[model samples]
Target: MTSTDELLVKEITVSRQSSGEERRLALHQIYVQVLERQPYAFERKQLAKIEADFLRNKIGVKRFLRELGHSEVYLNAFYYNSSNPKFIELCFKHFIGRAPSDQAEMRRYCDILMRQGVRDMITALLDSEDYSRHFGCFTVPHAWAEASYPSPRTFWETEVLLHELHGRRGWIVPTMVWHDLQLNCDGGSCRLPEPSLSSAPSSRTAAVISGSEALHQVLSTMGPQDLAAFAATLSTAERDKLRHLLMQSVQ
Candidate 1:
């Protein structure tokens, strides 16, 4: 048979394994997928211990997730020093595998946090009809919110939300978070807030230019005389803006 057919047959074979083996496999899958990293030696042992409890009916799914969420690795990865909104947003994404459908839904979870605690909020999500119907107890929740269903928000939030969840481990920490326009500091401790994206040039080449390197990349495409001709085409105001941007880059 073809590769696709062979792969499908293998998946079907795996699916037909005993429920106990399947559940253990699912728990292992959930650990890797949800945490987005391999578990450490001790972490693996702990997860196995918890999985034993889960399989033995000693703890329900909600309780199992609660214990996992409270573990040192989960706290370090997701919860350490995170703001309440960020933490709540992360819980919805990591556990429920979707962004909150609306501000009200996020607020409701925040309210749950204020009234009860993170434990109850997590349990409430785990016990939800949607979570049960989609993931049940054993299936790992997929992080690709937009692949299976359209995202409720305008953006998919894969970059921003994941960065928020992973924090320092993330490659980029966005300079702007909602209303907070952070001041970028230099070695001298001089603070200057970067211009908003709305103010950035709309051209594809210009949009990606954060510094002199990007500016240089754009200019590199022009011949020497073409550069002179382009400079001549710029309005006084545009030249001023360009100068300011160049200065920002060098600083």
Candidate 2:
């Protein structure tokens, strides 16, 4: 028998294994092995069959994506410019379901995307007007949103203002949450009142606010002892934001 026939025979043996989950896992391995070992044999018809098998048998799209993530051929097939949107939609649906496997795979994929600066791919997928129609439903994770756009200030500026206004405690708004708030605002027209011009603060106030331009004013006005005192009272989230702002100012 030919190699293709031999592979089919091996697949049959694995499929007949006692455990259903093991059998399914084996089938996925066999499919990946066939693609890797004899890629030239994968004509359009065979590829279609492979995809169907993956959809029917693979319990977790995240696990499948993780397996496929290890294969450059697979990644290129799904994510390259001419990648198939139908297959991507299938993967997205599988991922959205609560799967520990999905979370691990997503973390891996996000890391890869971040390192490659391929945020455009994710944004394009999310921004597609037909995304909901194609995927059924979609809700982006806050981390994904933040990674796609790094400018926390732009996205969360209004949220920050609101937090300041309300005297909310221990909340450092994420950049993506900020972005969503801004996008949802009226005509991109939301403004925070100048902190200096606002009513006088109580002695117990733990935070101060200033316009983006007045950040320098706040820093220049503080002595070393006051800066240390202020830093001591800030939450971790607030401290991180302050560090980010300091880095931006220096740059």
Scored by lDDT, model 1 comes in at 0.52
**Model 2's TM-score against the true structure:** 0.22
User: Which candidate number has the best TM-score?
Assistant: 1
For each candidate in the order shown, give its overall lDDT on alpha carbons: 0.52, 0.33
C-alpha displacement of 101 in model 2, angstroms? 22
Residue 249 accuracy (lDDT) in model 1: 55
Pairs that clash in candidate 1 = none
What TM-score fits each model?
A: 0.54, 0.22
In terms of lDDT, model 2 sits at 0.33
Q: Per-residue lDDT of 7-84 in model 1, one digit per residue for the tens?
A: 111111113234666656656655754576668887777677777876665665556677887676676766554444
In angstroms, give how far residue 74 of model 1 lies from its true place: 2.4
Q: Find the 10 residues in a row with the least total lDDT in model 1.
A: 4-13
Error of 1 at 167 (Å): 1.7
